[model samples]
Target: MTTPDKPGLRERKKQRTRTAISDAAIDLFLDRGFAHVSVAEIAHAAEVSKRTLFAYFPTKEDLVVHRMADHEQEAARVVRARPAHTTPLTALRDYFLDGLRRRDPITGLNDHPAVRSLTELIYGTPALIDRMQRFKAGGERALAEALCDTTEASDLTARLAAVQIIGVQWALSADNFQRLVQGETADGRYEGAVRDAEHAFDLLANGLAALT
Candidate 1:
C-alpha cells in the first residue's frame, strides 16, 4: 500500500477494533448487568487481549459512556462555529432542537430496552454516577472556554453561562430519559421537549440580562 493507503487501512482497522470492543461490552453488560461484566470478560468476548481493550477504553464505564463526551465536544464545536451575529445560547438552542427533531439519544429519545437498562444502571451505581459528574464538569470547562473565545463576557460570566447552559441540557436529558424509563415513547415527549428547551434557553438568555 502507498502512504495514503497505509493511513486508510490503519483507520479502518482501528474502527473495527473499537466497534468490536463496544459491541462485546454492550452485549455482556446487557446480559449480565454492568457491574457483573468485567473488562477481562469483555476482552475475551471481543477476542482481544485485555491490554487491547484498555487501549480502546481506559475504564470499563467508558465502553458505554464516552460517547457522551464526544457529544459535548460536538456541542462546543457548534457554538464555536456559530455565525458572528449568533449568540452562544442561540447556537446551543438550535443544536438541541436539531437533536430533538432527529430523536437523538443524547436528547434522550432512546427506545431500546438495553439503553434504558444502561441508563438505570448508571444512575444506580455510585461509581458510574461519579464518573458522569466528572464528564459533565469537563464538558462545562470546554464550553466555557469556547464561549469566552466568542463573547465579550468576563471569564466568570462566560463560565457561569456555560454551567447554566449545560445544566439545562442535563435536566432536559434526564427528564426525557426518565419519561422513557416510565414507558413514555419518544413520540410522547418529542414536542414537549422542544417547547421546554425553547423556554429553558429563553430563561437563560433573559436571566443573564437581568443579572447584568
Candidate 2:
C-alpha cells in the first residue's frame, strides 16, 4: 500500500505542489476569510496559473475545504479492508483512535494553528459548510455500500448503520473542532476527546450490531 509516509517520487512532487497551493490558499483564507478570498488570488499567491489551480481544485470552495476531502471516503475504505475477524465498527474505532494518537487533522485532534484557522474558515462560511456537508453525504453513501458488500447486509440496514456511525463521528468531530476554534488547545482536550470518541463508537457499534 502506498501510504503517505512512503510516497513515490512522482507522488512526492505532487504532494509538494498540492501543499504549496493549500498553504497559500489557507494563508489567504485565514487572513481574509474564506468568502472574501478569490480563486485567482489564491492561484497567484501559490505561483500557479488560474487554469492550473482549477485543474487541482474544481471550485473555490474546494480550495478551502479540500482538507476535508483528504479523508472523505476513509470509513468506506476502512470497512472494506478490515481484518476478517474484525467487525466494521471495531475497525473504524481502531482507525479513529490511531488518528487521534497521531494528532491527525482529520481527527479534529491536531493542534496546528492553521488547522484551527481552517476549521473557523469552513464553519463560518455558508458555501464552505454546504460543500463539506456534501462531502460527508458522499462518505456516508460510500460506507453504506461497503458495509453491504462486506457483510451482505441489506441496503436499508447498511444505510442505517452508516448514518448512525457517520453521524456520531461527525458530531464528535464538530464538537472538537468548535472547541479548538474557540480558543481551546488539543492537549487540554485530548483525553476528554478520546473518551468521547470511544463512547460515541460504543454507542454506534451497539446500534449497528442490532440492525436487522
Candidate 3:
C-alpha cells in the first residue's frame, strides 16, 4: 500500500494523548493483574477525564490491545497493493518475511521486554484474549474482502482462503513467540522461522492458488 501522509498537528496531539492513556493503563495492568485494575485508576494515572479515556479507548481491554488493532488491516493492505503479476499468497509471504527480517512484533519474532510482558498479559487475561479473537476475526473478514476484490474469487473461496492464510500466519507467529519465551533470541530463531514461513505459504499456495 502507498504510505499514508503524516497526521496533522491536531491528529498528532490526539495520538499523543491516546499513547499516554495506553501507556498508563499498561503500567497499571502489568503491575497489578488486568482484573485488579480499574478504568478510573488508569484515567487518573494518565491525567485524562473518564470521558476522554473512553473516547480514545472504548473499553479497558482496548487500552492494552490498541497497538495490535492498529495492524488488523495489514494483510488486506498487502493483498490490495501487491504488484499485478504477484499472487496474493506470494505478496503475503513476502510481507511476512519482511516483518521477520525487521523483527516486527506482529510476526512474534520480537523479544522486546515490553512486547513479551504485553503478550503474557494478553494470554493470561480472559477479556484480553476474547478481544484479541475479535480482532483476528475482523482481520480475517478484511482480508477475505480484499481477496474477493483483488482476485475476483467467489465469496466462499475468499473466506475459506482467508481463514487458512490467517490461521497459518497465527501459527507461525505463535511458534516464534514460544521459542522466544523459551529463551531463544530472535536472531537465533530467524532461520527456522523463515523456513517454517516458506513451508507454510507453499502449503497455502498448493491448496488455494488455483482458485485465486
Candidate 4:
C-alpha cells in the first residue's frame, strides 16, 4: 500500500498565507460591516501586498465568502459517493440531517458568535448577498451535473431536481439561522430543526410527484 503524500512546503506556505488573509478579512468585516471594510485594509492586516491579495482573491467579496469554497462541491460529491441502491434525494437528505446534528454552519444550526456574525453580515449586505446567490447557483449546477452522471435522467430533469433540492436546503438553513438570530439557543431549537428538515425532505420526496 502506498502512503498518500502530504502537501509540500510550497503548498503549505500558500495555504498559511491564504488563511491569514481570510482571517484578517473576516475580522475587519465583522468589526466594521462588510460594506465598510476595504480590501487594502485586509491586505495590510494580513501583511500581504495588494497584488498578492488580488492573486489570492479576485474580488473583495471573495475575501469574506471564500470560506464557502470548500462546500461548493459538497452536494455533488455526496451524490457521486452515495452507497449503491441509495437514491440521490435520500443521500442528500441524510447528509443534511447529519450536518444539523453536528451543528455545521452550512445547515445554519450553529449559534457560535462568529458563525452568527458572519451569517448576519452576509444577509445584511446586498453585495455579499448577491455573491452568495452566485455561490448557490454554482452549487446547484455541480449537483445537477452529478445527477446526470449517476442517473439516466435527462439534463432538464436533473437540473430541475437540483434546483428544487438546493432551494429547499437554502430555505431550511435560512429559517434555522433566523431562529438563532432571534435568540433561540441551538440546543433548544434542535428538535424543531430536525422536524423541519424531515418535513422539507418529505415534501421533496413525495409531494413533488403530485405536481406532475
- The most accurate candidate by TM-score is 3
Instruction: Report the number of the highest-lDDT candidate.
Output: 3
Q: Which pairs clash inside model 4?
A: none
Candidate 3 lDDT over 1-212, as tens digits, reads 87776669669899899999999999999999999999999999999999999999999989988988768988999999999889899999999999999999989999889998998898899999899889889999999999999887999999999999998998999899999989999999999999999999999989987855
lDDT of 1 by residue, 15-84 (tens): 9999989888988877788889888889999999999999999999888786566875665798889987
TM-score of each: 0.91, 0.87, 0.94, 0.94
Q: Write the per-residue lDDT of candidate 4 for residues 89-161, one digit (tens) a residue.
A: 8899999999999999999999998999999989999999999999999999999999999988788888889
Model 3 residue 193 distance off true place after TM-score fit, in angstroms: 0.5
lDDT of 2 by residue, 1-212 (tens): 86555558778888788889988998988888877888889989999999888888888888767776758899999999999888889999999888878888877777787677677778788998899889889999999999989886899999988888888878888888877877788888889889999999888867677532
Better-scoring candidate (lDDT), 2 or 3: 3
User: How would you order the candidates by TM-score, starting with the best?
Assistant: 3, 4, 1, 2
CA lDDT, every prediction? 0.83, 0.84, 0.92, 0.90
Q: Which residue pairs in model 3 clash with each other?
A: none
In candidate 1, which residue ranges exceed 4 Å CA deviation?
1-5, 210-212
Q: Give candidates' CA RMSD values in order.
A: 2.3, 5.0, 5.0, 4.1
